[model samples]
Target: MRTTETSSWMKQLTSSSRQGRHGHALHLFFTRLCLQPSIHGLVDPYPAAVPTALRACAHLANAASGRLIHALVLTRPALASDEVVATALLDMYAKCGIISSARKVFEEMHVRDLVVWNALLAGYARHGLPEHALVLAVKMRGLGLNPDRVTWNAAVSGFAMAGNDRMASDLVCAMQDDGFQPDVVTWTSLVSGSVLNFRYGRARMLFRQMVAGRAHVMPSSATVSSILPAFAGVSDIKHGKEVHGYAVVAGVEQEVTVSSALVDMYAKSGLVHEALRLFDKMSERSTVTWNSMIFGLANSGHCPEAVSLFDRMLREGVKPDHLTFTALLTACSYGGMVEIGKTLYRAMREECGIEPRLEHYACMVHLLGRAGKLDEAHDFIKAMPVEPDCFVWGALLGACRSHGNVELAELAASHVRTIEPSNAASYLLLSGALASAGKQNEVFKIKRSVKRRRVKRLDGCSWLETS
Candidate 1:
C-alpha cells in the first residue's frame, strides 16, 4: 500500500531519526513519515524505519502519529510479530503517555526480553508511577528475570524524581547488594532528580562524590546539564564556572544540553556577556538555548535585543514555546512596549498556536498594568478563558500599588487572598497602595487582618554577591 515517495519517506526517517537531536526538530523531520498510507489490504511495512519513527514520535509526545504508525505496522504480518518492532511500539506507547497501550503490547508479546521489561519499568518510573516501577521490578524477579543496571537505574531515578530520597537510596543499596554498583547513569539520575526537586545542596554533594571517583563514573554531558541548574538556581558562579571548566575538559561544552544549561546559568546569574559569548559559538541551538539568551537579555534590561533575538530565532526556523513568549512579553512590559506585547500575545495564539497559559496571561497583565492600563488589565483578566491564579492576581495587585489604584488594588488583593490565603504578599501590596493613597485607616485594617490571620511572610532572598 506504500507509494515510492512514502517508501522514500520511511528510508529518510530511518536515517534521520538516528541523528543526535530530540524535541521539535526531530519531530518535524519525522512527521512526514507519519502520513497515513492506505492499508486496506496486506501492506508491505518498512520494519527498519518503524522502530526509529516510533522512537522519534515518543520524543515529540506525538501519540496520535505513533498510533497511525502502529496501525500501519499492524497491517504487515512481519512487523506485527517482529520483537524489535513490537518493543519499539511499546516504548513509544509508554513514552507518549499511553501506559495502558504499552502494557497491552507487553502482554501480547510472545517473548518479552530484558529490554522489554526495562522499557515498561522506565515508563512507570518517569511518568510519576515509581510504585509501579518497583512492583514491576518484583514481578520481573518473580518471573526469573533479574533486573540489570538499567532496570535498577530506572527505578532509582523514578523514586528520586518523586522526591522519595529514602526509597531511592534503599534501591541503590539493594542494587549494590545485587552486585551491580551504580554507574554514571544512576548518579546522573540522582543528580537530575535532586535538582528538579529543589534539593540543590544534596545535588552538589552527590556531584562532588561522583567526580571524586566514588562510583568510578565521570560526569557525562547529561550530568553536566543536571548539575548546572543546581548552580544556576543559587547564582553560584564560582561553582558554575568550575562545572563549565569540567565541560570543556569533557569535550561537551558545545553539546546542546550542556550549552543550553550554561547559557541559562550565566544569564540567570547576571552574566549576560558570558552567556551571549557561549550562545554565539554554539553550532546548534535548541529552544532552551535561545530562550535562556532572550531571558538573560530581557532581565538585564536589554529589552530590544531580547525581542531582536526572538525574531532571529524565528528566522532560524526554531519553534517557540510558551516560555519564549513569556520572556518576550516580560521584555515588552519592562521596556514599556505595550503595543508590541499585545501584538506578540496575539501572534502567539494565532500564528504559533501556543494557547496563552497562566504565566503568559500574567505576563500580559503585567505588561498592561505596568503601562498604567489598570482598567484594561482588570478587563483582560475577566476575559481570560481559564481562571487566573495567584500570580495573575498578584501581578495586578503589584501594578495597582505602583500606579496608586487603591480600589482596584483591593479587588486584586482579595482575589489573591482567596487563591493563596496564607501568603502575606497580597495583603502587603494592598497596604502599600492604601499607604500611597494616604489611607492610613485602610493600611491599619490590612495590618490587623494580617495579624489576625497569623500570615507569615517568608524571608526574601537577595541576588547580591556574598563575596
Candidate 2:
C-alpha cells in the first residue's frame, strides 16, 4: 500500500511539473508519505524513492523541507550507501544552498555513474561555476566514463551560459569527432553559444543547415528557444518567418517554449504589432512569454503599452520579477514618463517588495535626465543604495548633450572623466557644450585635451598623431 501511494505520488509529481500549478499538492503528497514511520525501515529497497521526492523539494526551493529530506537520507545507513540516492542528495544539498554538503556527497560517491557526474556538473553549472563543471567533465572523460546526451548538453549549455562560445564550439566539434551525432539539444547549445558571443551569422548558418538538411532529427523547444534570440540579434524577419513556418509544420506552436521563442523573434525584429498579435493569439502564456512581450514593447518604443501590460499582469495576479520591472522601467524611460517612472520605481520597493536593481536605476536616471530634470536625476543617483556606475553617468551626460545644457554637461563631463578619462566621447561632448555656450576658447581647450589624451594613449604610434 505504501508502494502504491508512492507510485501515485510519482504520477502527480511528473504530471504537474509545469510552473504556476498547484505545486503544494505534490509537496503535501510527498510530506505524507515521508512522515510515516514504517517507511523509515524501507530504505534499502526504496533508496530510489526519496530522491524523487527531494527533487520536488528542489523545484519548489523548499530549503527547509529539502534539509529534512536530506536528514532522512543520512539516517538510512543502507540508503546512504546507494549511488543514486547520494547523487540526489547532492542535488538537494546544492539546491538548498548547502554546497559544502553537496560536495561531500559528490566526493563520497565512489564508482559514480554518468548520471551522478551529470547531476553534480549541472549543480555546479547552475550555481555560476562553469569552470568547476568543465573540470568535472574532463575528470569524467579521464575515468573512461562514456558521456551521454545529458552530459554533453549540460557541458555545452554550461559553456554557452558562461559566455565562452569558443569553448562550446570546440566541445561540439569534439563530440562530433567522437562519433556523437548532434541532437536538437546539441544544436541549440551551439546556437545559444553563438548568440551569447554575438556570432548571430554563425547561429543563422547552423539554423539554416538544421532546416535544409531536414536531418531525421527534429528541433526541440530548446532549439527554437536558442534560435529565436539569434533572430533578434540579426533582425532576420525572413528567417524568422521560415522558422515560424517550420514551427507550425512541426506542430509545436502551442508549446509554451516555442510560443515564447516566437514572441521574442517578432519582438526583436521591431515588428511590435506582429509580436503583440502573436502574443494575443497564444493559447497559453508563461511568465517568460509575458517577459518577452514586455521587453520587446519597451525596446521597440511602445513604452505606454509595456507599462499598461505590466499593470494588466499585476491585475491578473501574475508575480513580476526583476526582469519584469526592468522592462516596465525601460518603458517609462523611452516614453519620457518621468513621473510615472518615479512612482513605478518606488512601488517596486514599497508595494512589491522588490529592490531596484542596477538596470531599474539606470532606466530611472535615463527617464529623469532625458526629460531635462537633470537636478532630480542627480539627486536620485546620490541617494541610491549602490554606487552609480559609468553607464548611469553616461546616460546623464547623453541627456545633457541632447538638451544642450552647458552647466549639467560640465557636471556630467566631470563624472565621466573620473570614470573614463580617455574616452574621446566625453571630450567631444564637452567641446559641443562649450560651443553651444559660444565659449570659443573653452571649446579649443577641450579639443586640445582630447588630442593630448589620444596621443598619450599610444606609445609606438607617435608619428601618426600629428593631428
Candidate 3:
C-alpha cells in the first residue's frame, strides 16, 4: 500500500508537470497526496506532504482547510512524530492569528526543535505579545536549544515593539558576543526601536555603526522610514537631508513609504518647500501621503495653503477620511476660515459619509470660538452628538478670553475646572477674563479659589540651539 501510494504521488507530480499545471494545480495535487490513508502507517507518511498542505492552508487563510490538514496529520502515526510537520502546524496556526492553538501544539510536542521554538517566538512577537516572546526565548535557552538568527530577530523585535529598549540592546549585545553578525533586520530594529523611544542619540550611533561596518548589510526601506520620524521630532533638517541623500544613493527615494516619511521629516523641520518638492516627485502616494502634507501645512500655520490642498485632493478624486476632516478643521480654526470649516464639517457626514469624531467637534468649537461666535459655539458643544471632551471646553474658554465675556468665561472655566480642577491655565483664563471686565472682586474670588486649591502654573521654557 505504501509503495502504491508513492507511485501514485509520483505520477501525479509527473502528470501535473507535463500538463503545464505546475502552479496552483500542482499545489492542489500535493495537498491531496498527503491525506491518502493507504500509506498511513508508512515510515514517513506525512513529512513533505503535510508541510506542503500546511503551506496551502497558510496561503488560503482558511481555518477549515488548516484543521483538515491537521486531522490528516493526526490519523498518520509516523507523520505526527515529524518535527518539520509540527513546525508547519505551528506556523499555520500562528499566521491564522490563532496563537492559543499554536501554543498548544508547541506544549504538546514531545521533542520540540529549534524551528518549533522560533515559530512560537515569531507568532507571539507578531501578535503583539513581546513579553510572551521573551519568556519563550528564556525557556528555549533553558531547554538547551540554541537560538538561530531568526529566533534572535524575533526576540529583539518583540522587545523593541514593546518599548523595552534596554532589553533589546542587551539582546543585540548577547548576539554579538555569540559571534552572530547582525543582519539588516537586526540593525533596522535597533535604529527604529531607539527612535520609537525618542532616543535619537542611540539611533544615530547604531546607524553610524551599520555604515562603518564592512559586513555590507545595507539598510532596508523600513530602516529609512523609521529613522525619518526621529529627525522630525528633533527638527534636525541638516541630518534629515543627510539621511535623504543616503536614501537616494541606496535607490529608495521613489518608494512611497520612504518618500512619505521624507515629506513628513522635511515639513516638520520647517522646510515646507522641500516637502512639496518631494511630494510632487513621488510617483505614487497613499492617503497617508496626502494626510502628512495636509497636517504639515496646518501645523506650520500655513492654514490657507493647507485648505487649498484639501480642495485639490478632492478634485483629484482622493476621498478624505477622518484624519482629513481633522486636518481641514484645524486649518479652518487657525486661519479663521469659519464658513469653510462649517461647510467641510457638514460635508464630512453628508458627502464623505465619515462620522465626525470627538476631535472634529473640538475643531468646530475652536473654529466658532475663534470667529467670536461664542454663544453659537457654546450651543454647538451642548448639542454635540458625542460627549464633550476637555479640548471642547478648552476651546470655549479660549473664546471667552478673546471676547472678554466674563459670564461665558466663567461658565466655560467652570466646566473645564470640573474636568481638571488643578489646571492652572483654566483658572488663570477665568481670572484674567473677569479682571478685563473690571470685575476685580470676581477676579480675586477666582484667584482665592486657585490659592485654596494650591494650583501652580507650570514654567514654560524655550531652548536655544548652541553650535
TM-score of decoy 1? 0.92
Q: Which pairs of residues collide in model 2?
A: none
lDDT by residue for model 2 over 1-467, one digit each (tens)? Answer: 47797678556655655443436644654666557556546522244456666676677767777777667667777777777677777887776666677888888877777877888887776666778878988888898997777777778777877778788778777777877877887777777777777887788887777766754567777787777776664336776888888888888877888888889888877888888888998887878889989999989888899999988888888888888888888888889887888888888899889987777877888888889888888888899899877778777777777778888888888887888777666777778777877889999988787787772333443312122
Position 439, candidate 3: lDDT: 89
TM-score per model over all chains: 0.92, 0.83, 0.74
- Per-model CA lDDT versus the true structure: 0.90, 0.77, 0.82
**Per-residue lDDT of model 3, residues 1-467, tens digit only:** 37687667756655654554445533655455556545435323335556755755655565677887688688776777778888889888987778999999988898877888888898888777888887888888897888889988988887876678888889988888877878999988888878877888778777878877665678888898888887784436677788899999999989988999999898777788889999989888878889899888988899999989998898888878999999899988999999999999999999999998889999999999989999999999989987887778988998898789878988888888888877898988888888788889988888788788999889986534454
| Worst 10 contiguous positions by lDDT, candidate 1 | 20-29
Best by TM-score: 1
Best by lDDT: 1
For model 1, residues 1-467, the per-residue Cα lDDT tens digits are 34787677655565666663444434544454445454574445455766776788888888987898788778788889999999999999888778999999999999999999999999999999999999999999999999999999999999999999999999999999999998899999999999999998899999999998556689999999999988885457888899999999999999999999999999998889999999999999999889999999999999999999999999999999999999999999999999999999999999999998999999999999999999999999999999999999999999999999989998999999999899899988899999999999988998999999999988988866675
What's the candidate order when arranged by decreasing lDDT? 1, 3, 2
Clashes of each: 0, 0, 0
